[model samples]
Target: MSQTAPIRVGRIGYLNVLPIYHPIEAGEVAGPLSVVSGPPAELNRLARAGELDVTACSSIEYAMAAKDYLLLPRLAIGSRGHVKSVLLLSRHPVARLDGKAVRVSFQTHTSVALLRLFLERRVGIAPRYESGDVTRALQGGERPDAFLAIGDEALRLADHPDYPHRWDLGSVWLDWTGLPFIFGVWIARRQAAVAAPQAVAEAARALVAAKDWSAGRPEVVARLAAGQGGFSEQAMRAYFEGLVFDFGPREQEGLAVFFAMLAEAGHIETAPRLEFLDI
Candidate 1:
């Protein structure tokens, strides 16, 4: 616990965030920042615990800890429609699964919340759910009635023919609200933002610049995503292109819609008031 360390930054170490981290990944970019990478859930926990000064976090985690964090403007992992990852694969028709058990990935919070909202609102049936490694559960000879997989794993499981009913949560959200679905965002600890305003702003600059730099080189991200997960290069290309990294008005509206639904369904106490870094 180095109190005097330069802003401790965190990011999800997965292909989904390549556009934002590509410059850093290329070993061509350096700054007065301590970068710590982990899975989404781990990063979220580290951010909430104040171990990370700034982190790429699940929107659900941001919503839950809104008072302690300030969103870094103009960056996110969201999709307008047909996100190739973030899947809900069911053994039975989704609408008919009333009391069946489902396994959800332990690494995602936003996706799990969205899964519940979609199940109750769209399918009108609330199935029992447990969090675990979906692949491990299946490989261990335990077949849950249904399973939710997100990120790279979802993209891989989608090609399986046994799971006939595959639902892309992002596409469902688009269909439900005609807006983009935001899964993750970069948030700064409020105290860190106030005490190290320049550092926070500088980090924002680096990240936004990294995003711009990667935006110009989609081939780099496509190749990385495709090769890492054994996913089709064409599919990865489309996936990378389909994602919207901006935290503009339209993206905010989509988040508002999602929070409202989560609140109405009692998944959360209320929708959080979004706060951004003063920079």
Candidate 2:
């Protein structure tokens, strides 16, 4: 990587991350970054393909490929209780959905894994899963018993009349484990960190500063994101209030527990060690 080249950073193209990215995009926090926008699944693919130097990737994605990445400390997309987004909307009760087909959004990885952990492990039901665009399918009058929705789409479909039984996955996880659910974490490729430590550090500091700046101006952030999700400013504010962006000790504990559970359930080979970039 040339020293003059901007760091290629992956940004999840969702309203949930606007508070952090909005500032950077608006030039409130300056850094030598070339932002690549996509959904979590796409970003995860980019990270795996060695395209993204730094990204806010799915937490489970990082766990699956821990050897290739180092987490940026003190930054995450999590929820202590009800996330409002990242939902499982069903036509029937969750307990009775065994053997039913559940269409999962192609835009997720961590939410899919988390949903499986909830249904297969906690509820003791195995639902047939398939990938499709839930929003488009629903608009076309196709219903597959249940569907997983995340980010802005989830927010839009939160009160859809067609799906009366809705389960907020984050809330469900917290209720089951008594810990916050980390949906996404900022990370850098180990190779990138080693080759351009200064660039990585600059990106990390810019992200933290953006988060801090947004934290003090919730109303402004809400207004900026409200239009994207078709939500009122107040609703966006409440949604932001429900989210946890800091990766502190409690969040780390929750992530550890999630990894342990995934390993025990054979989703992953083993719980990878939590490694962080020393920025």
Residue 41 of model 1, lDDT score: 93
Model 2 Cα lDDT, one tens digit per residue, 77-152: 9999999989999999999899999999888888999999999999999999999998898889887799999998
lDDT for predicted candidate 2 compared with the true structure: 0.93
Q: Give residue 133's error in model 2 in angstroms.
A: 0.8
> lDDT value for candidate 1?
0.84
What Cα-based lDDT does every candidate model obtain?
0.84, 0.93
**TM-score of each prediction:** 0.94, 0.98
Best by TM-score: 2
Off by over 4 Å in 1: 1-4
N/CA/C clash count, model 2: 0
* Number of the predicted model whose lDDT against the real structure is largest: 2
**Which residue pairs come into collision in candidate 1?**
none
